[model samples]
Target chain A: MSWADTILQGVLLGGLYALFAAGLSLVFGIMRLVNLAHGDLIVLAAYLILVLVSGLGLHPFLAVLIAMPLMFGIGWLLQAYVLNRTLGPDILPPLLVTFGLSVVLQNGLLQAYSADSRRIPSGSLETASVALGPFNVGVMPMLTFASAVAVILILNRVLYGTELGRAFRATSDDAVTAGLMGIRPNRTFAVATGIAMAIVAIAAVFLGTRANFDPTIGPARLIYAFEAVIMGGLGSLWGTLAGGVVLGVAQTIGGAVNPEWQILAGHIAFVLVLLVRPRGFFPRAVD
Target chain B: MHGRTIPWRVETRTKASTVFAVLAAMIIVVGVVAPAYLPRATLQDLFFILTMLVLAQSWNLLAGYAGLVSVGQQAFVGLGAYAMFAGVVLLKLDPLVAILLGGAAAALLAIPAGFFAFRLQGAYFAIGTWVVAEIVRLLIAQWKTLGGGTGTSLPGAATRAMFGTDLVQRLMGVRPAQAVDIICYWLALLLAVATIFTVYRLLRSRHGLALASVRDNQEAARAVGIDARRLKAMVYLTSAALTGLVGALIYVQKARISPDAAFSVIDWTAYVIFIVVIGGIGTIEGPIVGVLIFFALQKLLADFGSLYLLALGLIGIVIMLFAPQGLWGLFASRTGIQLLPVRRLLRGGSLDT
Candidate 1:
């Protein structure tokens, strides 16, 4: 039963990782731009939601609705104005630029919120759980997991199903050719980044509710999100989900044995996976 | 082609000479009066700043030149610390000697890790290096000799006493701590100069040409007989070696080592990235200027706590959005001062200005 509980918990934890990696994977897939600011964006989203919930007196879910589109617009503007200019023959510009952005975002959040760890106060849902086959699961984790699955499904459908997805693929393949097709490559990139940030909002919602989070925690999230993205394979959302599961399971089992091994276990899994499959378990895109 | 190409230059010796002279002047003045004007600890703090500058320059070589943007060079820094720690804790060697060996060890370890990570490109390459760091962190943490998760301490004064007998101890007593610190500061200064000169020379060499070709367009480079992957690997290894050396300097002055302080991804990558980005990725003087500005910002906002990181993120985002070329790039465009010159179109192979 304890085994079952740990496994279930691991699966749910995977959900949060997937949430974190989804935006990262999407950004890479569509534009090959790895926003180093990804985790910070997640934290920023959490703060945005917190502001909404406390100030506007809305539930976390409603706050997410408000945050997602807003983040999308900010992302769109960021990509079109800032990020788009950095994309070129040299990938260094984006990296260095993003690193600078990371410094800026970390400071901005600190100035506004201070260093205090804040929670969304989910109330009843905090303790709410369901017993399934003699195993109990927290509602928050369950929701997070469900949300991750939903996000993946939606992302998959959008990438493979819609006209916009086609545009996305076309842009990813060759921006020059995509531009020749009158697709407005910059616009496509803007939309893609906007969508990526919207997904980040959902991840932020889960992250803020799951545990006490401060602005400083973003880098750690960035690490986990990066691991999950690479573990599954770059540009593969499903792989990100699986990658998160592998990390979550390893960490949980490691913690089950010795608490200190929890973080170590996840890192070990990442390294071992790299050793075996350097391209990742399922690589969908190549740089 | 969109337009007629403008030829780039190969040599930047004149500009480099000027910068070197200026640095010499600063060292001369600082060395003379720093003790009299400033407090003892401030000198130590300056030592730390120099250490950060060295790391920045090393990273610029790896990513700015080699085009391997690794987010996880901290592995080498941590390994260097551990090497020094092992020397003190296990082999009972001099901490000073251990410092050099720590860097050597870091370089040695980087050889294999670089080999593996260089197999990938772009973002995958970044992730690969990060994975190597993570593995090292986990593995080292398990090795009980080097303090487990909780970490270990450097052997205290008895260990420092062990360096020499009573006579040497008395020598050490007269040996002003400030003087030794100044000497360490000079060491850092020399190391930075060596690194700058080495990187500048490499960028001027034939191999540098090939590296630039690879970074611009790998396929084109491959078509033209350039081995992009191998060149990248060499740069990555060199970067690790430099980073490791910086780690040793940190240990010698710090006189202690720990995984958390050494392996910290934040400190290792953050300042490096900030300097390189703010200065200019491919520019020579950019990192030097960037590091000074960066240190100033950190000192100014030291009390801001995590907000500092948030500020860095915002700076990165803003820079990516607005000045993708970085501050040094802008400065170079305006003033044309090439402190660290790169390969330009050599006229009859005599590119020196």
Candidate 2:
């Protein structure tokens, strides 16, 4: 029974990891550009929410609603102006530019908010839990899990059902060919990043409510997100969730064995997954 | 036989060698003279620049030549540092010898790290290297003797008894601390010069051509009978060893070792990448120029705190966007200058010439 409870908690934890990875996977799927500043961007969104909450005296959830559009605009402009120019035959420029952006974002935040960790103060929502037969689960985790599912579902729907999604898929398939067919690869990429940023904002709300965060935390968060993405395989959102669950379960079980093993176990699991499936469990057929 | 003229001779020599010899003589003079005349603090700052130059050169060899942009170089840096600590504390080895062993240890670690990281391509490769570094950090953190996560300092006795310190003190007629600083500064200078010259020589060799071909196109290089993977792995290990040595030297000077400080991506990897990008990724002279620019910027704006990093990032982004080839590239385009002259020169005049 105890083991079952631990595993249940682990699965819930996976939801957060999934949310962290979804935006990363989306941008990669469309543009093949890995934003090294992604985790910092998420933190940026969280801080934006924090400011809205504290400055406007608004509820954290309501604050998230307002911050989403702002984050979308930031993401769009960032991709259009900064990242687009970095795209080329060589992979170094994009990675280097994003790394620079990561440094900038982290230090900018430090200048603005200092190095102190902050929490969103979710109040009763933080403590509320429900009995699920043998295991008691936190309401926040449940809500996080639900939101993750909703986000993935909505994303999948948009990706498969919309004309914009077609543009994204076409661009991903072959940007030059898509360009010839009248699709603006740059615009598609910008929109994809913008949409991904909105998802990052959603992930930020859950992340801030769960624990304290500071500027330095971004890289660690990026590691976990990257692990989930790699474990699931590139260009597949559902696989990312599954990967997160595997990571979450491994970490919890490792913690159960020895507390120091928790983080290490997740990393080990990622390596093990890579060893077994070099291209990940469900690699995209294209690349 | 000696008098017979060769019809087609590959002219490997260039006027750059003359320039290099002059520069080399100057460097030796400065290395010998600076310790006696310069202040201890100034020597220390020179040590910083020299060590950073070594790091930038190693990174350039890997990313610029081999096309492996590893953001996890801190892995080797930390491993080399801890290995030095372990060698000194556990094996009771001389600190100088332990520094060499640290380089070996990091090179050994690179074998498995390269195996795993080699599987991923492009951005995935970058993150893969970082994951491997994180794994190394976690494993090292579990070692209790190293103070686990908090880390431990080099024993006073171990530091005081470092080889050549007494010799340095007697020769320089300075205090023990100043003598130690002088020795480290000289060693750093030697390593920096050696690293740059070695890379310069390597780039002029046949293997350099193979590496350049591989960087341009992997399949084409492979089709030309070049063992691309082996060459890449060799470069990776070589750079790892050099970086490891530099890491050990750095820790030795400080007489301290910590997991966080040793394995700092921000300090080791990010800063080095910034240097490489802003200088020129694929050129020998780029790091020299980059390091000077970086040092100047750091000295001027370090007091501004986070603004310094912001400026670095902003400048890096601007350079990448507008001037991807970096300062060296910009300079070279305007005035076709090749400092090291790795490019092959045709001995005989072409038909047009």
Model 1 chain A, TM-score vs. native: 0.98
Q: Model 2: runs farther than 4 Å from truth?
A: B1-9, B350-353
Top candidate on TM-score is 2
Summarize candidate 2's per-residue lDDT along A1-287 as a digit string, tens digits: 38888788788888899999999999988888989999999999999999998899888899989988999999999999989998877888999999999999999999999999999988899899988887788999999888888898999999899999889999998999999999999999899999999999999999999999998888888888999999898888888898888888889988988999999999999999999998887888455
Instruction: Please give, for residues B1-353, the per-residue lDDT of candidate 2 as tens digits.
Output: 23544355466556766687688788788787898899998899999999999999999999998989899999999999899999999998988899899899999999999999998878888999999999999999999988999998888787667788898888878887777788888889888988998898888889999999999889999998999999999999999999999999999898887888999998899999999999998998899999999999999999998999999999999998899889998998898777777777666433222
Give me the displacement of residue A68 in model 1, in angstroms: 2.1
- lDDT over C-alpha atoms for residue B49 of model 1: 70
Kindly give the stretch of ten consecutive residues in candidate 1 chain A with the minimal lDDT sum: A95-104
Per-chain TM-score of chain B, candidate 2?
Answer: 0.95
Per-residue lDDT over A1-287 for candidate 1, one digit per residue giving the tens place of the 0 to 100 score: 48778877888899999999998888888888878778889999999999999999999999999999999998999899888888876777777667667667777887789889999867788889998778887889989999999999999999999999999999999889999998999999999999989999999988988789997788778889988988898888899999999989888988898887888888878878877998789987765
CAPRI quality level assigned to candidate 2 from its DockQ score: high
iRMSD in angstroms, per model: 2.9, 0.8
Q: Write the per-residue lDDT of candidate 1 for residues B83-194, one digit (tens) a residue.
A: 8788878988876677678878988998878777766667667766776787788778887887776577776652444333344335434343444465566667667767
Question: Docking category for candidate 1?
Answer: medium
Which ten residues in a row are the worst by lDDT in model 2 chain A? A278-287
The chain A TM-scores for the candidates, taken one by one, are 0.98, 0.98
